[model samples]
Target: MTGALQADLPIYDVRRPVLRLRPAKAWRHFQNLMKDKENTEEVFHIFESLPWRNLRPSAERFLRSARGQALRMREPNLPAILDDHAALRQMPAGSLAHAYCDFMEREGLTAQGLVEEFDRFAKHHVQFQDQFRWYLNRMRDVHDMLHVLTGYGRDALGESCVLAFTYSQQPSPAHLFIGYMAGLNIRRQVRSDAPVLKAVTEGKRLGKACPRLCEQSITELLPLPLEEVRRKLNITPAMHYREAHRTWAEMGVDPYDLLGKKLQKAA
Candidate 1:
């Protein structure tokens, strides 16, 4: 807690990371998540239930990467900078910071918002290697930023696409499962020909070719032009994603409210 002396205390002998999966728990959470998309806690629970992240193989791969090495050398307090809306607004008009701030303000969200959501899940209580814990938090924190960078919205489909993209960038089985499953679930509910799965597939393809944002310096990235940042990072246009939205719009449906209506009808 902030009330106590805060420090990144390292374990003298870090425990070797292990791999595990809890599909039943994740499925249970997913069921709850489906009833109400706003249940962000269930999302985290799903992630925790499939806790392969930062585990043995993944940990080894990360430690080998330049970004991971850099993070251990200096685990920056990224959320602090990201949460500073006033300072973000002070950035150049076209900078990523400005865009991020604008998105958060318009959506009535904050960096701390996701943080709080993650902490609500039981996994947050689990002890992790201090550095690895930061890596996880950094992954969690940049999620909304990914939405901004990828042009994905907070809609149900958009969330799946972002997670698909995230799976590509981070190679998390949990992310892959949630992303694809969520997309498929949407497809099952809707009667339209929106190529929902294809849009999510495109997200994975785009993610593969883009730079890993978690490894980048937040302060360095924030000042760069938004479009320029995308270009520099090799983030491509999400054509299929836009196409899905267009399809939904032409069909006289609000994709954001699509699932809710479908659920109500079923009820």
Candidate 2:
């Protein structure tokens, strides 16, 4: 019998799964700690205090510096940031809130779910400016994703902790230190052990892992599926895949399946 093999058949399912959790008592403990009355009060106080409210210009300056470094390294492009802003603009005013509700319902998060609650607040309160809205949106989206990638939970304590870790790894010490201080304040409110300090110190010792994860996990895993979604959703800039691939590679990452080939070639 003459057999026809479908040469283009997919060999592996490449869909990026939604965030998954590895059961850790530590996570539960952290959650419980955040719910204590004193902790909750402190967190609420910090939110209302607006210590950094007047620091918008400073924040913008820091972000611009970070963006400059990222661009110099060619690890990220402005187009993706622009696209993210466009997506946000296209979304209904409450679309993110609705999405958070749906995500929470589907994921079985309770009303007390810290991350879900924060998402609700972020979606509602985050403002958009005509010029820098795109960058801000990109930062907001990636901040959540970073939490997922770094195994940070969504509670006030968890986010504060991860922000410290992020600060340690970012190229700018000033940015990191500022965030670290904020995290310290939150940690004090939560009455949590100064874990953020440890995270930052450890991050400095271990180096940033996200760039590598982006190369090995996100780049290799997301491209085909993201492309499929783009096609199905009629998204533009099909070149985004190529741009992301090149950007990561330029940042000393090897996103190609060639493994050590690029390293050897570089040498």
Q: Which is the leading candidate under TM-score?
A: 1
Per-prediction TM-score, please?
A: 0.86, 0.31
| Candidate 1: regions farther than 4 A off | 1-8, 11-19, 53-75, 259-267
Residue 57, candidate 1: how far off, in angstroms? 5.1
* Candidate 1 lDDT, 157-233, residue by residue in tens: 89999998988778767787888888888888888889899999999998998877777777778899999889988
- Candidate 2 lDDT over residue span 175-246, tens digit each: 344345545555454332334455444433332433322212222222233334234323233132233335
Worst 10 residues of 1 by lDDT: 3-12
**lDDT values, one for every candidate:** 0.79, 0.36
Root mean square deviation (Cα) for candidate 1: 3.7
lDDT of 2 at 213: 21
Root-mean-square deviation (CA) per prediction: 3.7, 21.3
Model 1 clashing residue pairs (backbone): none
